[model samples]
Target: MRTSGVLPDAFTCSFLLKACVSLLDIANGKILHGVVEKLGFGSNLFLQNMILNLYGLCGEMADAMLLFDKMPQRDVVTWNTVITQMLKRGDIEGASRLFSRLEEESGLRPNQVTVVSVLAACADLCALDLGKRVHEYSNRSGFKNNVLVCNTLIDMYAKCGSLEEASRVFDEMEGKRTVFSWSAMIVGLAAHGRAQEALSLFSSMLQDGTEPNGVTFVGLLHACAHMGLVDEGRAFFTSMTRDYGITPGIEHYGCMVDLLSRAGLVKEAYEFIMEMPIKPNGIIWGALLGGCRLHKDIKLAEQAIQHLSVLDPLNDGYYIVLSNIYAEAGRWEDVTRVRKLMKARGVKKTSGWSKITLDDGIVHEFVAGDESHPQAEGIFRKWDELVVEMMLRGYVANTSLVLLDIEEEQKVKFIYRHSEKLAVSFGLLNTPAGTTIRIIKNLRVCEDCHSALKLIAAISGREIVVRDRNRFHCFKDGCCSCGDYW
Candidate 1:
């Protein structure tokens, strides 16, 4: 068309914009944006929406916002496009602000798509109050029965830790719930530790003629794993392929590995990985390594490390886990060799960190040597007191897991510097009395930290729930919900 001395029209530009989005060619999209401007079609509603969507897809939030702001007329699709883009970029505040301004400033009423997008943003940010407000608006606008809206509401409520509200939304939907709807509810239940409810809901979903999908099975399996229902997990794993015709994917395999590993079936879990039709990825092997750590199976842990190292050569977590395994098994030589190999390969250990949401809804994060908080000194002092109490309760400092050749006293100090401890101390200092402290760790919680949390929960009389990469550990009343298995 350029050779013919004619520029592409709006429709042609829209098609090219989609191609650029699919290919993630932001530069080409910019070139098309110029073409659209030069052709005097920038104001065309459809073309503008397409450009907005393309920028959003490419994660160019700034450009998408500029386009959205310049649009002469805004519709529901335009609003949804921009809001979804903001949510995708993790700009929850900006998305919420825009959502609030849409009706009053732009006279644009949010439709189901807009509501779903906003609800998803709420879910990602765990904005419970905003999610509840959106739910009320959805009801007032008579979109309560819209399946997509209701499903998103369920997901939002679940993610915001409002499982009851999620269930209410699930029950109130008028039509037969779809697989996604059921899956959302199941995921909610699983996340909230309502394992039996999740299983019952899965059975009900099956009975309602909604065939279970991979996600549904994953949720069900996770529920079973959390509840220690090993036989039920096995049956579900078998029924997934045999009865439902759903080939087990890597996620399914990972869930199965978690189930078997958590059930003290370390050897069986290792064999299951070998029997997988697809090559086991880092997640599956990592699950097995975790199991080995739990069961103290040094041999299987070593085998898992070998496979995982080859599968993810650049991943530092594998080395960390393997070194910890050797340390746990008192194989000092192997630990030393692993350390040397890591040093030779220039692989540094990734620092573990955890986050806790305070009463004001602000998430405070901490890592080793985190001195950024205003109350760091006080928090550390409190941590020292808790460590003393823990020691008196027969808590031995486990220096082996640090994978370092430091002195025992230094190892104890290092344990105090762990991210979870820092986060827990921060929670103690900042939160009111008896407030439950929920911490999320990026990696597995080390044995030292886990024991410390148990002590903290007991001494402080605070419920401490730590969600690590693998599973949830609820520490309360001097014990962990995981039975020290994790």
Candidate 2:
């Protein structure tokens, strides 16, 4: 068009910029911005909003904000665009603040899009109070049955530690349940250690004449894996292929491997992977590796690591786990080799972080060996006291999980002060008696912490639910929900 001397107007420039955003073509989007300026569409309000949205999608928040602030007239799109950008960047607090301004201070009514974004932010932060308020507002504002808004509410309530509320919204959604609706509720139930309920829900979905899709099977298989429902999961996998004609995708295969391996059927899990029609991906191998870790099967773990390293060579945790497997067996030479490989790959094992939601709506964060919190001194002091109590109650430290090749005493100390332990200790200190302590961890909870949590729950009479990298572990009365299998 430019070569034919047909210069683009504001409408044309905005259309192409939106295309660039959809295609994620930032390079050409900048070129289009230049064209918009040359055509003197720079000051055009509609074109300016498009430019702002382009920058937002590209994650150039500074530029997006500069353009946004300078605009003499702004509309709902401008606020929503910036708020969505904040969410994409994982700045949930920023998004919530902007969302408030969009509704209250800016005197603009939030549409369904804004509500969805806010609910998403609430979920990520595990801000249950705010999420409850958002749910109330959404219902009163007549978005209760809006599929996206309702689906997001399910996810928010689930992640914020309320599976019952999520289910309530699902039931009340009535005729508005979409595939996403089923997926959200199913996945939420699976993640929260309600595997049997999740599968029952799947049965209902099928009975309602809804076709099972890949996502649906992923949830079914995952629920089975969490509960060691091997036979059930196997049947679902077969049915997914034979009845629904949905060929087992990588994720579906991952769920199967996880299901089989978690049930101590390591040999069969390996065989299943070998017989896969498609080349197994990293996720598939990772599931098997996790199983190997639980069962302490070094041989199969080595096989999984070989394939996994090639696929995710830069993933430090896999190498660390391999080193750990060797370290557990006193295979010093092999452990040394794994460490050397990590150094060569420039892979550093990132420290784990644990987030605990307090009753007052504040989310507290803890990192391994982190001492930056204002209450760090008291938290650590309380941690030491708990350690003493647990030791007195015969809680032996499972120091095999401590990767460092250090003294025995040092290893035990390391396990005792893991971020999750500190988070749990802090929870006990701050919360009232009988209050359930829910903690979220960024990495897999180590075996030592798992054992300690069981004992801690027994001693303190507190029910603890920990959401780790793998799955939920509910500890009560000196036992874990996984029955020491996980």
lDDT of 1 by residue, 166-246 (tens): 888898874758899999989777765678889988878877888889999888988877767889999999999899899
Candidate 1 global CA lDDT score: 0.82
The lDDT of each candidate is 0.82, 0.83
List candidate 1 segments past 4 Å from native. Answer: 125-129, 171-176, 203-211, 339-348, 356-363, 374-400, 427-439, 454-466, 473-483
Compared with the true structure, the alpha-carbon lDDT of candidate 2 equals 0.83
Candidate 2 clash total?
0
After superposition, candidate 2 runs with Cα above 4 Å error: 1-8, 15-39, 42-46, 124-127, 357-363, 428-437, 455-463, 476-479
Weakest 10 consecutive residues of candidate 1 by summed lDDT: 355-364
RMSD of each: 3.5, 3.0
lDDT of 2 by residue, 60-141 (tens): 8887888888887778878878887776665656665676677687778878887887788777766676678778878888
Model 2: weakest 10-residue lDDT segment is 87-96
